[model samples]
Target: KESLDVIKVLTSKVRWITLLQRLTLKQLWVARNVSRVSIAIWKEKSQAVHQYCARWIYNSSIAFNAIDNDDFRLFCEALGQFGPGWQPPSQYQLREPLLNEEKKRTKEKLKHLEEEWETDGCSVMTDACTDMKRRSIMNLCVNSRGGTCFLGSKDSSKDSHTGEYIFEYIDKCIEEAGPLKVVQVVTDNATNNVAAAKLLKMKRPNIFWSGCAAHTVDLMLEGISKLPGIAKLIDQAKCLTIFIYAHHKTLDLMRSHTQKRDIVRPGATRFATCFLTLHSLYEKKALLKNMFGSDDWHECVHSKSVKGKASYETVMNIGFWSSMTLVLKIFSPLVKVLRLADGEKIPSLGFIYGEILVAKNSIKEATYQMERNYEPIIKIIDEKMKGRLDAP
Candidate 1:
């Protein structure tokens, strides 16, 4: 190692500035030539290659929200480190010239998709979201046997998202995507969105408007969570969560009992979080029983407080555990359907309607003869699905 270090020092002492400069220039020349030749080859290979590459970067930017000018430069610079033959596209090269090029390619592709869909038909799914600046944006995406593609987006903050306004937005998407090509439109179960769907159907009777299956199941969960019996249990569960998590010592004791798992897991939706919170509590039932009986719990001063005592007693109550079971029995199916609907691997259209039926039947069989218990839950799901046109 010492001899190698000495050899390295001796080699470092040599003046290779001119050689290094020549190598750098050669690399630059090679990179420029490769980039130019690559473009020429891309042109010869057909526009599909260009479109495929552009869609990859564009979709990645939208999916991860990480493609900025600086990020692009860093990505290209990192790639440049490998070899001069592998030149990277500049941000401007992508954002401006390549962007326009891709747009043209996309239009051509959209035209082709529209032509193909003329016979088979496609579905457009519309959703509204607010960006970081609190600006409402309307986005439209289309799916068919051919493939799925984003149609367009518009800033809708200024406009009232009335049925007519949304209908117009849908119309514009249809016009761009080819009106005759779209056979169905799907949106959330919001009243205005429902109205918009109805209006679009009136205009384009041949096209169906279906309510989003994911949103429908979420609403079902929301309704079920609000039932008086379930609501009380949820409140107790939340109180227990707050009491334990609010105090570090109690939280640590909880971790010790449950092998460091919180009694509440974060969820993407409100009802989802509510059910998951209850589910977590149910999972930690034994740990919680042990916790209330533990020496540390008895010694803790907060344990004597009204909130803490109430929470501890709730955990000890058999009725609370029973109520949790009922909650899970009624709502777990909705969670299942939610997962099935939100899945990406397979198309959901084939299974969602059938799953809704199975979910209803499972709950019915679980709570049979307890008509009072199951009636409201079944009613909510039925009413949500009624006339919503979810069938493929």
Candidate 2:
């Protein structure tokens, strides 16, 4: 009874009963009553059999390139060496056959996904990224009750990637995912993507098309950055940064003056960095002006340089300072709402509509209720939002 109990526990750990039925008679003989002295010869064969299933799973769930790393295999081997039940999967097992197995499993999952979609609708999202080879790949994913699942990916390098081309892919994904069960399609606010969304909407009038909010706000910022005054300010700010960082002496001096905080903070995007740099420069106005006016600044050769003169003049220009202040005032409200949409902790859908209204009103207030100044910026924002499907 004690021996039987021990065998049951061990066999259950390895799924021995199922494995035995699947094995040939000789393999079954080895699986059941292998001699301990001959076990070393069978270890590799036994390991391969057990690890074949594991290899398929790893290739499907994780990255395909993971099997290429010798370190990963070494780590798995070390675990198998220390642990008793299983062995490390060979890299060969992670190749062609494993990929085919993964495809089989994917078909099963898609069937499950379709079933879920029948009960609860799903949303599809498409995003394009350039892989290591610099080939453009469009990834299609579906979000259902089971969470987001990768449906497929298409390489667009050979394709036109126009609005019509994008729509074809979107339409195919929608069809594969069950068009009747799809609630919406989400994509970035790129020109082609927006056009694709519009075409998709026309085709399936009931399904909503959601343009990415973050991308829309970024477009708004991009439009603002193109304004003549804003463009000039950004150029001056970049020149100031280049001047300060070019010479070590001025860099140290500026750091000391500003208490080691850089006036130009890096941002994820070019326009974002431009605005953030402008904001930082505006905040440290006094310190920078004082630095330029200091006795040490007079002695420094950099202050006498051509670049230095331009930076100093820009910093001292009252017009430039006023423009910076105005830009900040107009965009700060929008930035706040953009942050809310970008955040992950809380869902922004609940407050985003209200927030946009407040933001537009705040911009009017910032311009001191002046129609001329505020109206243009408001109009730009409105046009951008409408184009991106962000407008109510």
Which candidate leads in TM-score?
1
Worst 10 residues of 2 by lDDT: 344-353
Candidate 2: residue 67 lDDT (0-100): 69
Clashes of 2: 0
Per-residue lDDT of 1-392 in model 2, one digit per residue for the tens? 99999998997978876776667777867766667646876897789855995688676897767667898789768877787776545788778777789889978987888789889999999999999999999999998777788888988898888998999899999898788899988889889998898898789988888887767777888887777776787788789989999999999999999999998887755666777888899999999999998999889998888998998898888998998898888778877777777777424443766787788999899889999877777887898878454532
**In model 1, which regions exceed 4 Å deviation?**
1-87, 90-101, 346-350, 389-392
Cα RMSD (angstroms) for every candidate in the order listed: 13.6, 14.5
The lDDT for every candidate, in the order shown, is: 0.83, 0.83
Each candidate's TM vs. the true structure? 0.75, 0.70
Lowest lDDT sum, 10 consecutive residues, model 1, at 60-69
**Model 2 / residue 112 / CA error / Å:** 5.5
- For model 1, residues 247-339, the per-residue Cα lDDT tens digits are 988899899999988878877678888888888888888988998999989998888899888988898999999978978888888888888
lDDT of 2: 0.83
